[model samples]
Each structure stands twice: as C-alpha cells, then as structure tokens.
Target: MKKIALILLVFMASAACKTNPFTGKKMLNFYGNSQIFPTAFAQYDQFLNQNKVVETGKDAQMITNVGQRIASAAERWLSANGYPGYLKDYKWEYNLVQDETVNAWCMPGGKIVFYTGILPITQTETGVAVVMGHEVAHALADHGAQRMSAGTLQQLGAVAGNVAIKDERTRNTFNQAYGLGSTVGVMLPFSRSHETEADRIGLQIMAIAGYNPDEAANLWRRMKAKSGGQAPPEFMSTHPSNDTRINNLTAWAPMARQEAAKFGVTSFK
Candidate 1:
C-alpha cells in the first residue's frame, strides 16, 4: 500500500507538471482548468448571489475597468511571448462586494472579488491596478491548482508514512514532526514563493497596462501601515512580510517599466 501510494504521488507529480509562461518555470498542478474552472465559476456566482455585489457604482466600474486592463495586458504579454490562446479557457469576471475585510482575491479561471473595505488602501485606480494585477497573476500562474496539488502530495505523504510505520509510537511521532515540518518548512515557503512570484509578474503586467509600477510598493507600504506592523515572522507566515514585498516591488518597478516599453506604454497612470 505504501509503495503504491508513493508511486502514485511520483507519477502525478511528473505527469501533471506544466510550464508557466510568465516565469518560464514548470509547475506541479494536478487540477486542470477543465476540472477547476466550472467549479470556481459556480462558486463565484453563488457568492455574488449571496453577497451585496455593487453592480452600478463608481467603485464597481473602477473594479471592472482595472480588471479588464490588467487581463488584457496579461493576454498581450502571453501572445507576444508565443502563448496565444493560453487564456482562452478563462472566464474572466470581476465584482465588488460590500464587505469590511481589507481583502481581494482571484479564483481560478479569473474570477475576482474586491471587498469594499480594500478601497481605502487602494485609494486610486492605479492602487487598484496594483491589487488587480497581483490577483490576475495568481490566476495566470495557476497558483490555486498548484497549491491544491501540493496539499494533495502532503496528504499522500502522511498516508504513506502511516502505512509504512508499524510502531504506533513512532507513527505518532512521525505525524507530529511531519505536520510541523511540512507546513513551516515546505508549505509556508511554497506559498510565500508564489506570492513573491505574483508580485513580480503583477508589476510587469500592471506596467504594461499603463499603471505606474512604483505604486505597487506604495500599496504595500499602505498595507503595512494598515496592519500596524502586526504580522507573524517571515518564516512562519504564508505570505512574505510587508517589508519584503515593499523592497521587492521597489526594485522590480524599473524592470517592469522596461517590459512595458516593449509594448509602447511609455507613460503610466
């Protein structure tokens, strides 16, 4: 049983790998768009039905406008880079919901929601672009499916361990250590890497869309201030520290502009 589980895990990892065009890196994603997108779209629709989705307001318009620009920029980049039709399967939808949580998220297949509470932090269209690009980047990179794949492997490992270990005490000890080690040492870092990847990719796409990439770091600064500097240590947190993000975005802004220059977007809003 243990050998079979291990073989299955290895086979899935090898067979399910795909290359992400933006970063030119291979990703492990067991869930494909055909399997994930319909579920995501239905859930997004259900959530909008249950929530106060602002459909006819300045905020709603801005969300749609910015999201469209970001998505277009991403598409342009992909096509220019030889990945035309990469997003053909994506059903992009954006909505603004009346919620107090200072959060915005993009589901697989480009479903996005912006809570009203995040507007203050966004402050301007460019600020909103900063967030929109990041969310879209997550979708473009298939981060959701990759995380699910990682979680599946994590569970498979636990099961394999239990099957292989005959001593009950040793099995319990292995479970405890594996749980902590896998999360803190592997899972958290994996998530943090994804966040950082999104930041870089988002910066470039937002710049290509004619939004000032500099505002990406500024947005994070505002985010840090809003958090009152309250956050877990970098190693333990799923996302990178605010300071780290600010620094990375600051350094990457110039390069992002260079990327935009290729698209003839010399000035930004």
Candidate 2:
C-alpha cells in the first residue's frame, strides 16, 4: 500500500505541473482555474456581504483605481510576453472594507479587499499601489492553487509513512516528526518563496503602471515599524522577515523600472 501510494504521489506531481509565465518556472498545481475560481469568488462575495464594504468614498475609489491600473499593467506585460490570454479567466474586483486588520488580500481569481486600517501605512496613492501590486501578483502567480497542491502532497507523504510503518508506536512517532519537519522544512520555505516572488512581480507591475518601485521597500519599512519588531523567526514564519523584504524590494526596484521603460513609462508617480 505504501509503495503504491508513493507511486501515485509521484505520478500526480509529474502530471500536475503548470508553467508560471511570469517566472518561467513549472509549479505543482493540482487545481485549475475552473475549480478554484468559482469557489474563491463565492467566498469573496460572502465576505463582502458580511463585512462593511465602503462603496462610496475616496479610499474606496482609490483602491479600485490602483487595482485596475496594476491589473492592466500585469495584463499588458503578459500579452507582450506571449501569454495573451493568461488573464481571460480572471474576474477582477477590488473593494475597500471597513476594518482594522492592517492588511489586504487577494483571492485566486483577482478578488481583492483592502482593510481600512492599512490606509495609514499606505498613506499615498503610490503607497497603495505598492500593496495593490503585491496582492494582484499572488493571484497572477496562482499561489493559492500551489499552496493547496503542496498541502495535498504533504498529507499524502504522511499517509505513505503511516502505511509503511508496521509498529503502532513507530507510526505515531513518524506522524509527529513528519508534521513538524514538513511544515518547517518544506511548507514554510515554500510560502516564503511565494511571498518573495509576489514582491518582485508586484514591483515590476506597479512600475509599469507609473508607480515608484522604490516605495515597495519603504512600505516594508513602515510595516516593520507597525509590527514593533515582534515576529517569529524567518525559518518558522510563512513570510519573509520585514528586513529581508525591504532589502529585496530595494534591490529589485531598478530592474522594475527597466521593465517599465519597455512600455514607454519613464516617469513614476
């Protein structure tokens, strides 16, 4: 049973790979847009219905405007790079929700929400572009589907271990060790890599949209300050540390600007 399970896992992984055009890397993704998008859209609708969605306000309008521009930039980049229909399945929607969470997020198929509390950090429209770009990048990269795929594989690995171990005590021990080891060694690092990828992609798209890429790093600095230096160690955390993000964004800003120049955008906002 264990051997069969291992074989099945390997087969699935080999067959379920998709190439991410932006990164030009093949990633494991068991779920397709058809399967993930509808569910995400439904959940997003439910959340908006449950929350206080600010429909008529300056901040709300700004969120929509920045989101549309960033998304358009991404589409332009994709079309120019030979993936003309990459975003065809994506139904883009952005809304501002009245909340104090100090965060924003995007669903799989371009559903985005900005919490009111994050406006202070994103003080200007350019600053808002920084955050909007990051969130949109996650959807563009299909990080949510990748994460689900990874989780499925992680569970299968544990199941294989359990089936292979004959002794009950040994099986229990393997489960505990596998849970911790897989999370820290594989899952956490995977998540961190996704975050880093999003940051880089976001910077490029925001720049193409005539927003300053340098502000990406500055946004992270403000994020660090807001966190009060309280965060888990890098290895244990799902996202990269604030300092790491700041440094990465700073280094990538020039390249982003170069990319924007290809689209005839030289002056940033």
Candidate 3:
C-alpha cells in the first residue's frame, strides 16, 4: 500500500502541472476546470439560494461591475502574454450576499461572493475593485484546484504513513506529529505564498482596470484595524499577517502602476 501510494504521488506530481502565467511558475494542479468547475458552480448556486443574495441594489451592481472589470483586466493580461484562451472555460459570476461577516471568496471557476459587512471597510468602488481583483486572481491562477490536489495528496500520504507503521504506539505518535508538521510547516506556508502572489497579481490587474493599486494596502490597513490584532500567528495561520500584506502591497503598488502603463491606463479611479 505504501509503495503504491508513493507511486501514485509521484505520478500525480509529474502529470499534473500547470504554468501560472502571471508568475511564470509551474503549479501542481491535478484537476482542471472541467473536473472542478461544475461542482463549484453548483455549490455556489446552492450557497446563493441558501443565503440572502442581494439584487437590484447599488452594492450588488458594484460587486458585479468590479468583478467584471477585474476579470477583463486579467483576461487582457493573459491574452497579451501568450495565454489567449486561458479563461475560455471560466464562467464568471459575482453576487453580493447580505451577510455581516466582512469576507468574500471566489470558487474554482470564478464564482464570487461579497458579504455586505465588508462594505464599511471597502467604502468605495475602488475598494471593491481591490477585493475583486484578489478574488479573481484566485480563479485565474487555479488556486482552488491546486489546493484540492494538495489536500488529496496530503490525505494519501497520511494513509501511507499509517499503513507503513505496524506498531500502534509509533503509528499514533506519527499521526500527531505529522498533522502538526504538515499543517504548520507546509500547508500554512503554502497558503501564505498563494495569498502573497494573489496580492501582487491582483494589484497589477486592478491597476490595469483603472483602479488605484495603492488603495490595496489602504484596504488592508482597514482590515487590520477591523481585526483588532486578533488574528492567529503568521506561522500558524493560512494567510500572511496583515502587516506583511500592507508592506508587500505598498512595495508592489509602483510596479503595478508600471504594468498598467503598458496598457495606457495612466489614470485611476
């Protein structure tokens, strides 16, 4: 079982690679949009049905507008950079929910949701653009599929470890240690890196879409205050610290403007 698991892992690693056009890095993504999108779309549809989906409102319209602009900007960048059909299979949809959680997320194939609680912090259309770009970046980069693939491999590895350990006491100890090591040392860092990448890519795309990239950091500043310094430690969390994001976005703002300049987007909203 252990050997078979090892072989499967190796095969998956070799067979499932997709290049991230924004970063020029190869990502492990065993599932493509065909494999992941329908499920996400259905889940997103069910979520919308179960939640209070706001319609015929300014906030909802803003969400849709910002999402479309950010997605178009990403598509423009992809097309210009030799990935012309990168988003051909993506069916983008954006909806605003009447939840007070102050959060937003995008599913595997561009299904997006914005909770009304975030509006106070966002406070403007450009602020929505900032979040919209980041969420869209997740879809563009196929982070969802990659995460699912990684999760499957992680579970398989756990099973393989248990199978190889005949001694009950040793197996129990290994399970506990493995869980902590993998979550903290591997998964947390992996998620943080993805957040950082999305920050940079989203900044550039938003800039290209005629939104000020500098506001990205300002938005995070509001997020930090909203958190009241209550977030988990960076190493234990799945995302980078607010301070880290503020600093990185501040530094990347100028680069994003440069990228926007290439598209003749010299002014921002």
Candidate 4:
C-alpha cells in the first residue's frame, strides 16, 4: 500500500502538471474541466433553486455584467498569449443571491454567485468589478479542480498511513497529528497561495476590463474595516490577512495597468 501510494503520488505530480498561462506557473491539476464543470454547474443550479436568487434587478444585472467583462478580459489575455479558446469549454453564468453573508464565489467552469451582503462593500460598479474579477480569476485558474486534486492526495496519504501502521493506538495518534500538521503546514499555505495568485491575476483582468486596478486595494480596505480586525492569524488561516492583501494589491495596481496597456486599454473607469 505504501509503495502504491508513492507511485500514485509520483504519477500525479508528473502527469498532472498544467501550466497556468497568466502566472507562468505549472499547477498540479488531476481533474479537467470536463470532469469537474458539470458537477459545479449542477450544484450551482441546485443552490439557485434552493435560495432566494435575485434574478431581475439593477444589482443582479451589474453582477452579471462585471462577471462577463472580467471573464472576457481573462479570455483576451489568454488569447493574446497564444492560448485562444481556452475558455470555450466554460459555461459562464453569474447570479446574485439574496444573502447577508458578505461573500462571493466562483465555481469551476465560470459559475459565479454574489451575495447581497457584499454589495454595500462594493459600493460602486467599479468596486463590483474588483470582487467580480477576483472570483472570475478563481474559475480561470482552475482552482476548484486543483483543490479537489490536492484533497484526493491528502486522503490517499492518510489511507496509506493507516494501512502501513499495524499498531492501532499508534495509527490513531498518527492520524490526529498528521491531520493538524498537514492542514496547517501544507493545506493552509496552499490555499493562501491560491488566494494571493487570484488577487494578482484578478487585478490585471479588472484593469483590462476597464476598471481601476487601484480600486482593488480600496476594496480590501473596506473589507478590512468591515471585518473590524477580527480574523484568524495569517499563519494559522487559509487566507492572507486583509492588510497583506491590501498592500499587495496596492503594489500590483501599477503593474496591472501596464498589462492593460498591452491590450490597448489606456483608461479605466
């Protein structure tokens, strides 16, 4: 079992290397859109049906518009970089849900949802664009699939450990330790890296979509103020602190504009 686990890990690491065009980094993604998108689409549909989805309103329209523009901008960037039709398989859909959670998320294959609670934080259309771009970036980067693949490997490791450890008490102790160690040391950091990457990539796409990349930082500032400095420590959490994101976005705003210039987008709203 141990040998099999090692072999599987090696195979996945070598065979599942997918190059993320925007970042120039090779990501480990064992599942493709074909495998993941349908599930995400179905789940999204189910959620929409179960929840109070705001289907017709100015806010709803604005959410869809920004999401579409961000997705288009992402496609333009990809096509310009010699990866045309990269999003052809994506069935993009954006919706606004009537919730007070102050959250927005994008699923695999471009399914996005924005909660009503976030609208106040995104005070303007441009602010909406900032949030939309970040969510769209997650879809474009195949983060959902990558996370699923990573989770699979983590479970496999646990199974291998259980099978190899014949002492029942020792195995139980190992499981407890391994769970904490892997989650904090590996999974949390991995998730934080994805969030940071999404922030950078989202900034560029929002700029190209004619939204001010500088607003990305401002949005985080609002988010920070809204949170009231009550968040888990960065090292212990799966997300970077609001302050870290604010600083990173501020520094990257100029570069995002430079990227927008390459696509003939000189002015931003």
Q: TM-score for each prediction? A: 0.99, 0.99, 0.99, 0.98
Residue pairs of candidate 1 with colliding backbone atoms: none
Residue 160 lDDT in model 2?
Answer: 94
Expressed as tens digits, the lDDT of each residue in 151-222 for candidate 3 is 888888899899999999999999999999988888879888889888888999999999999999999999
Give model 1's TM-score versus the native structure.
0.99
Sorted by lDDT (best first), the order is 1, 2, 3, 4
How many times do residue backbones clash in model 3? 0
Q: Model 2 reaches what TM-score against the true structure?
A: 0.99
lDDT by residue (1-269, candidate 1, tens digit) is 98899999899888776999988788988888999899989999999999999999899999999999999999999999999989999989999999999999999999999999999999999999999999999999999999999999999999999999999999999999999999999999999999999999999999999999999999999999999999989999999999999999999999999999999999999
- Candidate 2 on 60-134: residue-level lDDT in tens? 999999999999999999999999999999999999999999999999999999999999999999999999999
By lDDT, the better pick of 3 and 4 is 3
**Candidate 1 — number of clashing residue pairs?**
0
lDDT per model vs. reference: 0.96, 0.96, 0.93, 0.92
Residue 215's C-alpha lDDT in candidate 4? 95
What global local distance difference test value does model 4 have? 0.92
Superposed model 3: Cα runs more than 4 Å off = none
Residue 116 accuracy (lDDT) in model 1: 98
Model 4: which ten-residue window has the lowest total lDDT? 6-15
